[model samples]
Target: MAIDSDYTVNSGVTTGVIGMQDPLYLAPGDISGLNPVASPFNDKHYLKWSRAVKMALISMNKVGFITGKYPKPAEIAATYQDWIKADYNVMCWILHSMIPEISESLLYVQSSKQLWDEIKDRYNQANAPFLYQLRKDVMHTIQENNQSVVNYFGKLTSV
Candidate 1:
């Protein structure tokens, strides 16, 4: 009988990897953050291969926008470099706070009307009461949530 091969067992193997004297077991993710989890196979060796793969993918893009040459099939994976993904989700909220993510290149490309439109849309999104709501997004959503800030501001501004 032909010996049975386990496809799951060999998923971690890659060609052209140097200094891989020890097999990769713990993926980069399973070992990241405060409390880490271990994968069954590579637990005794090192970082989880799955998490490592994800980190490599994350590094290939900014806000998931990739802008680089594709590597040849044989390149060894590199460590992912990125800000927390949640930061991208909070873009509008942050920009509404008079913070923007515009870089020098993007700033010069806009026409005056485009700039005004951007400004108007951002500040005029909600009425005065709702405008105050976003300031508390981080705090309220995280702990001790409330809509009281809106009422207080509404009373003060009377609008």
Candidate 2:
């Protein structure tokens, strides 16, 4: 029996056609390009940008490529080279979407995991004073006499 790309087997017989889309394939504009919303130099904004980028990464299913958790294709597979090429292209596109200051430093780094770790290690440090200030802000926030309930709540949550 000859097998074709659209062939599907049912009960011991080749039956209906099955058109499979590649799960790893990412189309352009599937997700909006992430732009830096805040400067990494500002501690609060650094955290916000980090969160926004992380969310974008998660939505793209490309987070694993940067986290070192994505599976590698078997070396014997004929498409292994193509898979690697495609993955590398995706990684570069994501890396370039970051702020120029951050992305420039990462240009020389080939591995996505390395670039991700370097950024996280440099910016995602523990800061007791910053956290304390944020907590204080949240606690002291109260609905102003003129502020609507919804607006007040939004301000509190943002802090």
Q: What is the lDDT of residue 103 in candidate 2?
A: 69
lDDT of 2 by residue, 15-57 (tens): 4332224424455654333342333333345567767666666
* Candidate 1 structure quality by residue, lDDT tens digits, 15-98: 222122111122344222221112222222122332432354344221121111211112223211111222222222212222
Where does candidate 1 stray beyond 4 Å? 1-109, 127-155
Best by TM-score: 2
**Looking at model 2, which ten-residue stretch has the lowest summed lDDT?**
34-43
Determine the backbone clash count of candidate 2: 0
Candidate 2 C-alpha error for residue 54, in Å? 2.8
The TM-score obtained by model 1 is 0.18
> How many pairs of residues collide in each model?
7, 0
Q: lDDT values of the candidates?
A: 0.29, 0.60
Residue 128, candidate 2: how far off, in angstroms?
2.2
For candidate 2, the TM-score is 0.62
